[model samples]
Target chain A: MNVYIIGIGLIGGSMSLDIQVTYPEAIIHGIDVSDAHLEEALQRQLIHQKATLQNVENADIVIVTIPVHASIKIIDEVLHTVKDDALVIDAGSTKEQICKSIAAHPKRRNFLAAHPIAGTEFSGPSAAIQRLFEGKTNIICEVEKTAFSLQEKALELFKNLGMRIRYMDPKSHDKHIAYVSHLSHISSFMLGKTVIEKEKNERDIFDLAGSGFASTVRLAKSSPAMWTPIFEQNKTNVIETLDEYISNLQEFKNLMLQDNFEGIYKEMENTNYIKKILKGLE
Target chain B: MNVYIIGIGLIGGSMSLDIQVTYPEAIIHGIDVSDAHLEEALQRQLIHQKATLQNVENADIVIVTIPVHASIKIIDEVLHTVKDDALVIDAGSTKEQICKSIAAHPKRRNFLAAHPIAGTEFSGPSAAIQRLFEGKTNIICEVEKTAFSLQEKALELFKNLGMRIRYMDPKSHDKHIAYVSHLSHISSFMLGKTVIEKEKNERDIFDLAGSGFASTVRLAKSSPAMWTPIFEQNKTNVIETLDEYISNLQEFKNLMLQDNFEGIYKEMENTNYIKKILKGLE
Candidate 1:
């Protein structure tokens, strides 16, 4: 089996790690915009050989894991180069834009739009780890748009990577992700910004911050290059979620201003139900 | 040694677990408003016995772990009953109010205002675990107000429990904690409310959520009984922090509305400094 992985970063490099272990006969070729990333991936054995977009013709499987903005720019050309039997997949965070952008491509049937919901706050080849996708959900959007045999091939690879597959329409996938995933990143990043801005005045404020603050703000450490385009592509949905979130925070502030302790207590009690709901999820 | 723990929930129960192990000869007497909790503490060996506020008269060390609102009401009474050599410390999240409440009490020297910056989202005696305080920061407010010898005694126990001590005035402690601790809880709780409210309309929204959402929302699972009083006690500082937090979110949303991807990306890049700051912290 011949596999070509574009971007050689966390998601691609991690997928390369798992794929090589699962398919010993599969030759992994890495393609990246950065010479440094490609070189590092080779040194780390995340890929077997360095390759490029032109070399994709030889691929039986091609996984594109670049920024969503970059993905839209090249996914058409990637589809143009891959052979008829090849199964191409993208693990971008937002799918609706990419799926829509490639709708008219001649080789569209070979491409799969999947988002494997897995990551650390770190990025790049060095940040990649084996089993990154283990027991995680892989949301495949517009699966019917991909050819049946190619979908089967990608699903087989996903299973080998220890992932659970859930299929959804692109619109629904982007909308749902705006609430669960994108909103949290914005919330976390803004929280980090708010606190750090405060730190300029309050020396050693972080010294007193415990594990709770750390956990809640951890996602602020995510890659801006990656998330910026996600927010751009899913702008409408993200804006909607942000409006709701900001309003919620505003309402909560008003409750405090009004000295409504009972209402505040009730809000927290209601949200505590998240504990039971998230029990088996982690 | 007689060690009285007056509130056997997560914080109190956890301190009891560590204290008993540290002071091997110390008999831990658990006090709670609930009999079931006391009975559970006995069965779990979290405490040697159950006692009430009146029993504090026999105490050499008294630790109050109740809600901050409750702490202010009962603290002076507990200090009145403890012996001159006793160190009565209240581990409440908001220190200024409690500290000021007991300021002129005759037994003022016996009181220590402390906030141990440690805990899991879980609560109750069943949630108690050993080593909870290991390598965690214990913020002591108004330390000089406590009797010097008795302060030394409590400091020794904190060291034995593996905590790092940082001294701050009660006002600064409450102000800083309002930003680091309380603000994060409100953010997490509001985020949880936003998503859960969305889930009511969007079926299976959470299945698409990943570890990021879970981590960011984890604190929302914390007890309402524990946090409501905290928000109430730290109202002014929390309001200030919330104003800045909401304003930050509004600014980000405005950037989104204006299509200022550069500004958005720059904001995230700047806040990425949190990655380095929080490295050794976790």
Candidate 2:
């Protein structure tokens, strides 16, 4: 089997590593815009060979793991170049734009839109690690749009990587992800910005940051190059989530100002249900 | 040596475990209002004995690890009861109020105002773990007010527990903590509240929550019994931090509305300095 992965950064690079283990007999090819990333992927043995769009013609499977905007621009081209029977998947965080771009394509049945719900705050090829997808959720949007045989092959691959699959329409996927994933990145990034701006003394922040601050601000360390596009692509949903978040903060502040400790405590107690919801992710 | 820990929950319980390891010969006595917690602490063997307020009279060292409001109400009584030579310390998140309340007490010289900058989201005796303070920072406020010998003993104890001590004025400690620690908790709790409110389908949230969402919302799981009094005690500083945080979010929303992708990218890129800051924590 021949597998070609384009934009080989954290997700693409990590997928390459896991796929190599799952399909040892398969030949892997990588395409990335950054020469440095390609070099790191090679040194890391994430790919057996480096290839471009023209070289993916014979590929049995092509996976696009670039930034969402880039994925939207290049996914249709990838579909056009791959073999008719080949399977193509795009693992972008925001799926609506990418899925819409190829909805009317002649090779639409050969493409699948997936968002593998996994990652660290770090980025780049060096950030890739084995077992990243193990026991993680992979959301497949517009699954009915993909050819049945190709969907089966994709399912086999996801299962081999130890991922559980869930299906949703592209629009629902974007809305849900905007709340669960994209908004989290924004909140964390803004938190980091607020702290850095208010507490000019970096040493004080370093000295006082406990595990809570570490966990809450961890996402602020994510790649701007990747997340900026995600926020832009899902702007409406992201903004809606952000507005709700800000209103919640405002209400909390009002309760604090009014000395309504009971109200504040109740708010947090209500949200404690997140503890149970997040247990599976741990 | 006799050490009495009042309110043996996460912080106090964890401290008892570490202190036992550091000073095996010392007798550790615990006092908590919750019988269930006291029972759990005893079952976990976190204390050598259970004690009342009268029992603390003979204590050579008394550590108050209760909620900040309770700490303010009871610290004076604990000070009045302990031996003249006893080194009394309170490990509350907000230091200004606690320090101010005891500033004029005759036994003030025997007390040390300290805030150990460490904790997990979980709480109670069950959450207690050995080495929780290892390689973490412990801030000592109003150090000059503490008796020289008592300060030395406290420093020795913190050192034995593998904590690095940094000194700050009580006001400065509370202000800094409000931003670095308290604000993070608020952001996380509010984020959790917003997402929970928006995503009615708990299953969707459970299935789609990625590592970033989990990290960003981890602090929401913290015990409300512990945090409510903290917000009450640090109201002014916390409200100020919340205002700044909300304004930052509003600005980011405006930028998103305008499709100012470059502005959003730069915000996250600048906060990426947190990567360097948090590395020290790990």
| Candidate 1 docking class | high
C-alpha DockQ of every model: 0.89, 0.86
TM-score of each: 0.99, 0.98
DockQ score of the complex predicted as candidate 1: 0.89
**Tens-digit lDDT track for model 1 on B101-176?**
9889999988888888889998889999998989999999888888899889989988987999999998888888
Q: Which 10 consecutive residues of model 1 chain B have the lowest summed lDDT?
A: B200-209
lDDT of 2 by residue, B147-244 (tens): 99999999999998899999998888888899889999999999999888888655665688888899999999988988999999889999999999
Q: Return the lDDT, model 1, position B41.
A: 90
Clashing pairs in 1: none
Please tell me which predicted candidate would have the highest DockQ against the true structure. Answer: 1
